[model samples]
Each structure stands twice: as C-alpha cells, then as structure tokens.
Target: MSRYQEMAVFAAVAQAGSLAAAARQLDLSAATVMRSVAALEARLNTSLLLRSPRGVALSPAGETFAASCQQVLQAVLDAERSVLGLHSDPAGQLTLSAPLLMTPQVLLPITLAYLDTFPEVQVVSQARDGMPRLLEDGIDIALVVGPLPDSSGFAIPVGTVRPILCGSPAYLARHGRPATPDDLRQHRTVAWTSAGYVTAWRFCHGQAVQWFKPTPVLSCTTQQAAIRAAVAGLGLTRCLNHEVHRELQDGLLETVLDDFAPERLPVHLIYREGRRATVRVRTFLDFAVPRLRTHPALNG
Candidate 1:
C-alpha cells in the first residue's frame, strides 16, 4: 500500500484506540489495519503501536508520529479541496447525523432538496438519539437538539423546542386540568423510561424551576409508546412539543401547564474540524444553515 494510505490507517488506529474500532470506522478488516500499521512500522524502522489483546496504545514514537500524520493528512485534504479547480463543481460524499425523531419530518425535505441541487454530492444520514463522537464516527455534521456541550465544536443556532405536558381531552375531562405542578400528583401519568425510571418531572414557574414526582400508571421504554398511551387517554405525558404536533392538530392530545413550562431547548448545527472541513462539508453547512434556522417546528 502507498505511504499515504498507511499513514491514514495508522492515524485512524491512534484516534479510535483499537484496530477493530479503526477497521470499523474505515470499513476495512482488522487484518488489513494490522497489515498497514505493520508495514508503516517496518518502513520507519520503529514500533508505532503497543499491541494487546484488549486494545492498542501508542508508543512514545507513535504518539509523535501520530500527530504528524494528522497534520499532514489534514493539510493534504485541504490542499486537494482547494486545488480541485476554480470552476469545478462541489462533488463529494458527506455523512450526517440528526436526532431520531427529527430526521423524517425535519431533515428529510432539506436533504432531498440539497440532493436535487447538488447532484454530484452523495449523502448518508443516520438518525441518532444522542450526541455522537463526530471525529471517531466520521460524521461531517449533526443537528443537536439540546444545549451544546462545551467545545463540542462550532455551532450555528437553529431554534428551540419545549418539553411540553400533554393529555387526551377525555383524560383531562375526567382528571381535571392541572393548573400547577402540585396537581400532577392527582393525575395518572405515562412515563418515558428511556433515561431510566423517571420519578420526577421538572417544570418552570415564574423564574424558578421545580421537580414534581408523579406516580406512573405506565412506564414505556420509548417516547412513541408513552405518547401513544397519552393519546389513548391512558394518562398525561411529557415530550417535546414537535413530537406531538400531529396528535395535537388531530385533537388526540392537548398541551397542559404551558405557563409552567421551562425555557425551550436550544437547537444547533454542530460540526467538528472547523477550518479543516472539506469542500463538501463546508458546502453542505452553508446550504443547510439558513433553511434550518427558519424551520417552524424546530424554533419556538
């Protein structure tokens, strides 16, 4: 294999922390990653990685060489992107990630439009539930639904979503509407157990936030089930406002305690690699940002 390919393989191994993990990231076999590293080390006349049954760690030389490889590869990529041609159309593959529920309704339309606009570009998007390791997973960009983590990467504000409380009209008619957080105790609840058994739900009133623990009649592992229970008049439930849009529009659910709701969750387009981002990555970000910022469902 070429020195360029070998260096790229070694760099992937160093970043991923294991040959198997690196192979998975690169879509190569474990044996191929091992061979690349071995060949690179033989050519350099020094061991780069310390091998083990559990995983691999960089040797002292490997650490230094790994840094150089990253810099060199990045520089090469940047140069290639810049030198492709002055009039050359943007053409490359981009991998993206978005929240699971938002993909179909929110991101799908934008993606299809982008494909129509840029026929030379290929796209692969994964519906992810939480923040993904961007570099390790080779994700070019992600649409994050909550507060952005510190130094996660560059972010462009999109909009916000509220954690809303809702119940069927029938359920509300029987249980009475909860005007305050304390009234949650007098009602049946359907709890989403994705984050474990949720005993308490938090709400904001005036300028203060408080938690109200309600006894749940049903505990569901997925949000869809919890929402379904609420729609069937089983009990009240809490979920993001956009998640229940169709149900609310259809009169299957009605939001309660809006005055007690906290500040809406902020959304953003987050991407790593900053200035080193490829032409396809940069092009997609530019194309996607304005459209995302104006999304009605995502922003309050």
Candidate 2:
C-alpha cells in the first residue's frame, strides 16, 4: 500500500502495456501488480487504467498521472545520486589526460598524492598534445594549458604558467644575456615547434611592444629535447617556468629578459558532461589547487 511502490508498479504497467508483462518486468506475481494498482486507484479515488481483452491502456487520469510519475521517479533517483556522491568514498578507475609537457610538471604530482591518499581509486593517465572530446574519448578529467577555445564541458581554474626565455650559464657567459628583445637576434636560439605555429614570440618592456623570431640553431619537436639542448648550453630557449624549475633551482638555467615576460598562461581542469565526480577527483582538486596557487613556478 506504500505510495512509492504503488506508483512504481503503475509506471511499470503503463510502460509494459499489460499486467502480466509488468509482473514479469517487476519479477512479482500478477496479483501483486494488480493489488498495487488497485490500491493506488482507491487511494486517489479514480480509475487510473483501462483493462481490456487486447491489452492494458491508461485512462484519461492515468495518462496525466503517469507523466508526473516519471518526473517524480527521476527526481528521486537524482537526489539519491547527489547524496551518495557527497557521502561516499568513491571507488573506480579515473581516467585523466593532459598535454605532454604539462603532464609531468602539473598532473603527475597531484596524481601521485591522490593515489597515496585514496587507495581504493586507480588512475589511468594519458599524455597528449591536443585536447580530446571527453564524451567521445571516455576521458574523466583533463589538464589543459593556455586559454581554452569555447566548448561544452565543466572547467575549474587550477593554476597558470608564464612563458619566459631561459638559457644556460655557459651559453649566457659565451654569448652574453639579452638585455632587450632586440638582442635576441644576435643569440643562437633553440626553437620548440608544435601545432604549426613557429617563429613568433610576444613580449612587453616598459611601454615598448616587442616580437622576435630566433634564427634556429637547433629545433626540437618535444619539450624534453628542447630543455636538454638548452641545459647543454646549445642555445637560449623559451619555456614555461615549471618546465625548468628544477634546472633553475640547480643553477643549470637562468631566465633572461624578465621585464618582457609574456602574460601568464592559464591552466584549467576540465571534465566531461554528466560525469559524476568521485571523491578521488574531488580530493585531488582540493589539494592540488592550493599548492598550484602558491607555487613559485606558476603565476599566481
């Protein structure tokens, strides 16, 4: 006689088009389905269904009530999911993706910490240079750098990185540091190429607009290779601050033209549509956002 059970049975009967079929669907005796519907009709003081030899059909009242029932049922299930997400320690494999250079510096540490804290969750991380369609590709979360193009997805601002010019001490000692953007033309530079945009750098220096195209003595397709060449004093290069943080700390690299540093590169954590966020993903964001906010390697 419970209203919930009555409504559920009514919905099943309406959907299945017959008491026998509805009983089969609910795995209950046909008598049970009949009594539930009867109780429901009595409680409402209206006949909600029409019984015929051919099949079952909804009465005028039943037709209207069934639509309402579907909405109510969906709301109840959504509420349950919301509460479960808030209370439960989520367990499942979380798949994440990020650009190749960004993966090591930004995503890796957060992932390591997440695993240590949440032993129940497993991570599958992929490094790629381009963003994938989360719904189509089945990615749970992604770390993206720079300004994002307009699209449908949920995103939270995590951090920022500044693109700056850096060179080895030995290289600077031999060629001298570029005091101004104009000096870049005299230096042997390492070019990092990606996405078909090459030979352009943007900077600002005390009311002066400057752009430079370095004559490439060495060109690299990967950030690691570019950093390696710069570390070996092959040429001056431009890179995000975090990419050379360790090298800078170890005195393997020094930043030049600081006054002309480009605008901070924005970082974002994006997720797929209708994706139920688990505790593992939530916990990592909580811990990671704070650290990223204060880290000197990133722009505040």
Candidate 3:
C-alpha cells in the first residue's frame, strides 16, 4: 500500500478502536485492515497497538504517530479539495468542543446557522464542563471561556460573559435576597462542581476580590444541572449570564449581588495554528466571530 493509504488505514483503526469497525468504515475486510496496520508497524519497527477482546489501544509511540497521520491526511484532503475548487464551498466534518451549558444556549445556535449557510458541512459537537485536549479529541474548533494557557493555537477574542448569582422568584421571596457577597453565608446555594469538587464562587469590587466557598445544599457536575436546580427553586446558583438569560427574561429567576459581581470572563474561539486550519474552520471563524462578538448576552 502507498504511504497515504497506510496512514489512512492506521488513522481509521485508531479512531474506530477496533479492526472490525475500521474495516466496516473503510469497506474492507477485517483481515485487510489488520494487515495494513500490521504492515505499518513493521515498516516503523514499533508496536503501534495493543489488541484485546475489548478493543485496541494505541501505544505511546502509536499515539504520536496517529497524530501525525491525521494531520497529513487532513492536509492531503484539503489539497485535493482546493485543486477541485471545492475549498470555496466548505464541506467536511468539523468537531467542536465547549462547556455543556454553552453548547445548547450559545454554540448550538451558531452551529445551526453555520450549517444552514453551508449545507455540505457536518458538525460533531462535544459538550463537557471542563477542557478537553484539543489534539487528542480531534477538535477542529473550541469555544473557551476564561483565560487560556499559552499554546501554539490561534485564539480569536469573541466576547465576554460574567457570572450572575440568581435564584427562582419563589426561592428568593421565601429566603430573602442576598444584599452582598458576605450575606451568601446565610443562603442555600446550588453549586457547580468539576471533577467532584465544588468550585468557589468569586466576587470582586473595585480593588477587592473575595472567594466564597459555599457549603452547597445541592451540588452538581454541570452548570446546566445547577441552573436547573436553581430554576426549580432548590437554591441560589451562580452561572454565566448567557446560561440563564431566558429564565431571567421570563421572570423565572432574578439576579442578586450584581454590584459585587466580578469582571466579565473573556470568551475565545480557539483552533490549531492558522497555517494548518482547513477551509471549514476558516469559514466558520468568518461566520461566527462577528455574530458572537455582537451578541448582547456575551457582550454585557
């Protein structure tokens, strides 16, 4: 097999996690998929995968090689599409990652609009509370909120979202509203946790910053769940303004301690190095950046 064919087979097997699944995807026999991968290992003189009844797991070396293979394959596909003049009409699978709550409220609407404009493109979205390894997860784009670590990728500033402390009208009416950050101690809170530990609620005013570690009456892993709990009148919850915009608008929830809220968190649309960006990625950026930056909820 040619080097390109070998790389394609290896990448497929790595992604599918099983020879049988890879074969099905490639419309080749299971033995053929296995042989192609085995040939690649032989050529490299390194064990690429550990096969078992459950599935195949890449070795450390395999992980490194697979990343390279994916890049090469993508470059090749981009080249072909460019030559065919199809690059102007972006078409391919785009994998996007963002926080769970933001996916439904913010990201999904943008993606749906993008798809409407470019029907040829397909999107696969991954929603989780915490960051996922962009390269490992094969994410084409990520909508990240807050400070980003120094990295090779390009990050385009979209807008900002500030955390808002809010609760159902009924909950606030019964328990009374917190007038200041310090008064939160007397209130029950629905806290959002990451990796099983609740995150401290932070507030700021002028030069002062305060961290309130709430002994939450209810703790949940996702912001969406915490927002739901708060809306159900369980307790007060702190989340991004965009996450609860509809509820706040409909009079289901009301914000408190607005005077002490922290500075707005920066929102960014991140992707790999610009030189490596595919047509779909660039197109999405052009399509999304202006809209996101102008969004009232994100900008406020």
Candidate 4:
C-alpha cells in the first residue's frame, strides 16, 4: 500500500481506538488493518498503539502523530481537489457564507461536527454582511435568514427566526414588562446600530404594523454585545431568536413582545446548483440541511 494509504489506516485506528473497530469502520479485513498499522510503526521506527486485553489505545507518540496525520491528510485532499476537481470522492473544500450572528451560535458547532464526520472535507466559512453571490464568490452554500432580493439559487428551506425583544428578570422587575412596543419608551432600550444613532423597531400583529423608534440607552454594533448588556440588566435588547437561544433556555432573559413580533424570517440553504454541484458540495448540503432545520437556535 502507498504511504498515504498507510497513514489513513493508522489514523482510522487511532480514531476508533481499536484495531477491530477501525477495521469495521473502514470496511477492511481485520488482518489487513493490522498489517497496515504494523507497517506504519515499522517504517516510522516507533511504537504507535499499546494493545490491551480490552482494546487498543494510542501511545504518547501516536497521539501527536495522529494529530499531524489529520492535518497532512486534509492538506493532501485539498491539493488533490484543486488539481483534479471533485467528481467522485466526497473529499474537498466547501465554502459556506452566512450572516455573522448565525456563524458562531447557529452554524459553528454543526460545521465542526461536519469536519469530524467527513475527514477529507475542509470548510471555509465566511461571515457575510450582505447577501452572498455564490457563483461569483465560489461559495458552495449559503445559510441565509429572511427574504432574498436576488433569489437566484436552489434554496432549501431550513427553518425560521424572528426578531425578539428580551430583557433580564432583574431589569423587568425594576421597570415592569413592556406590554407593547410603544411601552418600550418607559424602559431603557438597548438598540443594535452598526453605524446609526437610532432604531425603528417594527411590530406586526396580524395585518396591523406599527413602528416605534426607541431612544436607546446604549447602542451596540454587534448583537452579542447588545445581548450581554441586556443580560447585565442594562436594558431590553432586540435580536433574532437565534441570538438568545441559550440565554432563554438558561433563564438569563425572557421574551417581552412575542405578540408584536414583526415577522418570522425563513432560513434557507442556498446553493448555486443541484445535480451539477461537486461531490463536496452535495455531501455538505445533505449533512447540513436537516441539522439546521431542526436546530432550536433558528427554529420558531
């Protein structure tokens, strides 16, 4: 077998933690797996696995070697993809663009898990401020929230998220809950303004739409910063449901104006093409679509 093949075998063994387990995972015979592992150790002049009656474990050198193995293997795959193009193997780079708020909270964990699951696939995640041009940007997929003005891709509806107004229990107790968006004037409002001084919060109940411009006690550039300030009892903050998912679950914040919520923005996984897509893109979309659809962070 080739050196790369040997490294792949050893890496699988390290991950599975046993020769038999790795063999099963790779769909290779136990004897072939064992031979590959032995060959690797002999060639490197190092003892990699320490076998026990129960199972096998990586030695100290093996642990360090395994980490490098993953890196090297990924680098090789990346190079191969660049040269050959992804026709058959689900191994290559996939670029995903998304809104900044969705990246860390709603997308990072899933992407990290995808990397683990598809060992040969590398991900490039871009946090976009505006709608992405997938074909122009060479992006494989985009996780978008809300309406698309361009609407030029194959969209897979994932879920929905709405703008939420929330405040800490302490702040609510100090200045009773705002019954309506207009009542926010009675309370300190923390508005998210990247470059502006004021914010017009729109509320929609059925067909009636109302706009309330809050005089913010504190204005933040980032949604997370606004949420933090609100959590500290500074004031009520407005953000998407995905932003305060953990906060709501942990009881750090409570929703204030559910009845006046403006609109539920649909989340979509937009890709440039369907059948013509690379194997890397197809596999990634299949992995991410269902996960995002059911994730509580974005779901209404």
Clash number for each model: 0, 0, 0, 0
Q: Residue 182 in model 4: shift from native, Å? A: 2.5
Q: Estimate candidate 4's alpha-carbon lDDT, on a 0 to 1 scale.
A: 0.85
Q: Lowest summed-lDDT stretch of 10 residues in model 3?
A: 128-137
Tens digits of lDDT, candidate 2, 1-300: 578878898989988889999999999999999999999999999999998888789998998788667645644654575676643564556778888777776668878887887777778898876666665555668877777777738888877888889999999999998898888889998978865546688888777778887778888887789899999999988888878877888999999999898778788888754345545566656766776667666662
What lDDT does each candidate get? Answer: 0.85, 0.79, 0.88, 0.85
- Candidate 3: segments with Cα more than 4 A from true spot: 15-31, 53-67, 195-199
Question: Which of the predicted structures, 1 or 2, would earn the higher lDDT when compared with the native?
Answer: 1
Runs of candidate 2 exceeding 4 Å displacement:
1-87, 195-197, 273-276
Error of 1 at 204 (Å): 1.7
Ordered from best to worst TM-score, the candidate numbers read 3, 1, 4, 2
Q: Which candidate is the best by lDDT?
A: 3
What RMSD, rounded to one decimal, does every model reach? Answer: 5.9, 12.3, 2.6, 11.6
Clash pairs, model 4 backbone: none
TM-score (C-alpha, index-matched) for candidate 3: 0.88
Name the best candidate (by TM-score).
3
TM-score of each: 0.74, 0.67, 0.88, 0.70
